[model samples]
Target: MLLQLCLLYVTIWLHSVSAQSSSIAKPGCLERCGTQPVPYPFGVGPGCSMERSFEINCNTSFNPPRAFLSILGGEIMGINPTNVRVNMPNLALSTYGQGARILTVVYGLSTTRYTFSDQNWLTAIGCDDMAAVTGLANRSFSGGCVSYCQSAGDSGGVASCPNDSNGFGLGTGCCRTPIPKGTTNLFVNLTDVHRNWRNNKLFSTSYAFVGEMVTSNFSYRLNDLNNATIFLSDNWSAKNTPPVVLDWKIGQQNCDEARRNLTTYACKANSECVNFDTNIVGYLCNCSKGYQGNPYLDPGCQDSDECADNPCDPNADCTNIPGSFICKCRKSYGGDGMKGGSGCTKLPPSTIINVSIDIDYTWASGKTEISSPSDTRPFISDIV
Candidate 1:
């Protein structure tokens, strides 16, 4: 009977707690842009978002509503309230530097540039190929990769170009280099395009690009040169590009800097403003650990229910508090009863043990004596 009552109480507590902290969008603003959950600080229309940069345009022309970024043009996949993600636009660039014009894929350096995620790899794919991907790096912004292989067979010179189960003449040859933090723009340039191997020289074409880890074939045989066998993941040859993962924010200043500007400061009650570690620039707002929802709305940060998962033992009581919960042991039990904590157990009763005692007698003097075999130990306070 007690267990039933406890469970009922917990259910009510969870519901009430949630009701007090429901996530709310701006007044009269659409909570959703197409099918996407338009969380606060980010909205589809004016007066809905925290700033101009946070605006998302909902295109209803498609079968389902599709959201696109006005500043960073790309189709929206989905947005997580806790951890936000956006896809940066992708473009494949391929051209040979015959004598001077060495060109390849590039991402930023425009009026509107994306912070190329550090996760994206700057890759070079070819035999006798050296590619450089320049961005923000080591006080400046520059990095790259280099690969070399024989035109046909084994001719030991530099590094060995190992092949897998994928047949010969198929140069799955690849070289990798890491993209660092604060990459505002990425420029991929194919260097050493024309190099002599033997009779089979590499005056042809090689590939270099900065993108995600997805592969496809690029048959590089432009005009009379032919002979462009390179395997690059992220499918540089396909016109339909994969989504580029990008971390976005409302402004370029850190939390303290944003707060100083009252008119522009966006985080609401119980919300926290965080600065981007990638660069000392952009910032993001989030509800505090115990809360959830749009931190830009009034009373925006809502309380989270920790008891929804039945975290406490049946012999304990669950109490929902602001930003946290408490699990208390019942009258008949002891110890913390919450999940991961020492659960409630049968209570311990009075305990006694045999021991020696030193005492002063008013009838005589003082004497040290051993306790009787059956004598119960004295109360701690009564001793001495």
Candidate 2:
């Protein structure tokens, strides 16, 4: 039964691929399966998918359905639903917000992916407070922002003047510094610290997260420690992939270098073979558009047809074309293809001719274009 189900799924996927080849807006555009809109270079349809490392299984059983991006050989991160807003967990703080903390999370990349060759380091933030963040073991960087005020004033509400002066993380409320490049496995600690500030209730609210510079805004709310609402925005990029950015090249190689010896290299038919730019070792395969499967196998990328999935108006008929489908009026129909027409009506012959003749070539074209530019305009105009 499982085998049969798998076969059926493969067959359906192939048909879907073939039907959607022509109308695909972006050649390699990623699609949103459930609530999560797969970003570019990572797609849901066949052949449009990323490497196995980036495959995401979209589960459609939940209320709105959810998608899980796979990592670490199929380990699940979390589910993202379609059209639903996703809020990443925030990095929490302890030690009355004065301590620097680091989160150890894996970013999908190898060691050679950093451009500067120097790994990323920890940056600290505070007022009269200095903290250091670190990654791995030896890689590190340090800097802090200063808070200045004179004679605690009663004008700004309660007795807490220094604390109230700093706004949210917009810069004035707190300070932040940059981490070095290539750093991973982070750790944070306080250095060049002032014990008096730590003891005070105002400075006691100091907090930190991995990517963000400081936790300055509305006095590090104590409840934030229990709530996973803060998160650090880490800058990570993969090499030899879509949305090119400066980074260490992973599986890249020139065609000539790869083609000379095919034993070790694994580029398949219809796929371009390339060498790693940074390491000068290893090769990778990229299947062209309109096809997807195992690039290393005899068959490459297969087409995908979205219409089979019934992603169209229910009342319309889906006619599958090579790489796409044409939504049209069903048999014996007269109205637009969106909603089923009153099946074919026998208009008075006189009326038919009059209707045809009344439509001027230029006028008809202009009206049609103006009314339904992509032919997707909802049924609103009179067709008679």
Candidate 3:
């Protein structure tokens, strides 16, 4: 019985997946590079992508192969419709002197369909280190954080050092600040806070970089801080560098402006245009409500039959409409008929009746007296 139930669930899931419309690349375009799925608007070669800036290069030199952005020139670690995760280099400051060093990360995404997402945070990791990060993409933005010397066992300050494997930036040996939206070009400056900390062996190397909040992994360890060889090794570099998320859109114009030229508009039939809320001007296409498919392709998004999901009450009838569904009560029933609303109720019988009657009463005052004839009238009924 359990095996049968599991099989039934799998069959239902497969049917549901097959019913949904596809969002794939053009007929002749390459849809994937290595293991990365190069969906429509993003392709592997010429004539594959919607634009030149969306092109991706598949590097086969690696063991399992890797995908990189052709225009921006960064290894593509992960990708979705709205965001792309890339392997960003870290800003390392290695010196004994109590001085500051500046490192600039110029992504040069001004001419591309990409921008920095606000999901990233500017983080600095080291004892006795102060780091500031600035951006110059759509506007001028800056934020900084400071970290003090704190061991894994120390809990002296209000915010203690991260003792767990998952190191959280809490101002002790590590600190992090949020970066503003639409930041492509980044500048980071790392400064050694105290001169006396330079003499200490534990405070050797400092690291700073802009990394996505969810994927970054910079753990706190006293042994890692003391050893310079392990901190600067290739194995450490691969594990320490954080993934940066980049937001991509269809074009550099608003939905209204892009709609003026129908030939160049990205949104097709059965789809709507959504403008970006950032300082940059761009738009994205989405399938209309109750529809699923690629909005950028011909024949556009396909309407989904919501009634197939049995969204209506068991006693109600569900009708599939264009991009929507309607639910109504069955014959001899009334009410909204939806499962969430007042479900179908039985209607009253189609019949009417009326009746009239006369009554008499006697008054008793010392002796029984009969009621007046005019007072004894027929009473009409209200029910029908």
lDDT of each: 0.60, 0.39, 0.73
Model 2 per-residue lDDT tens digits across residues 1-384: 999999999999988766554222235444566556564233454555435434455667865655554332221223221111121222323344534443223332344322222212222333344444444423344443443212122124221112222221333223444444444344454433445445433333333433312223223322222233232223211110011011232234566666777774555555665553333344446655434554544444444464656644555677766545566554444444443344333334343332212222244445533332334533444343
* Top model number, lDDT: 3
Higher-ranked by TM-score: 2 or 3: 3
When superposed on Cα atoms, how far off is each prediction in RMSD?
8.4, 16.9, 10.1
Stretch of 10 with least lDDT, candidate 3: 157-166
TM-score of each: 0.67, 0.38, 0.75
Q: Which stretches of candidate 1 lie over 4 Å from their true place?
A: 1-25, 33-35, 80-92, 95-102, 109-114, 147-171, 192-206, 213-241, 349-384
Cα lDDT tens digits, model 1, 238-318, are 442335555565666788888998778878788888886644465777889878766877766887787886889888999
On the 0 to 100 scale, the lDDT of residue 6 in model 2 is: 100
Error of 3 at 278 (Å): 5.6
The candidate with the higher lDDT, 1 or 2, is 1
The 10-residue segment with the lowest total lDDT in model 2: 236-245
Q: Alpha carbon lDDT of residue 205, candidate 1?
A: 51
What residue runs in model 3 are displaced by over 4 Å at the alpha carbon?
Answer: 1-23, 60-65, 95-104, 150-169, 196-201, 215-218, 232-240, 345-384
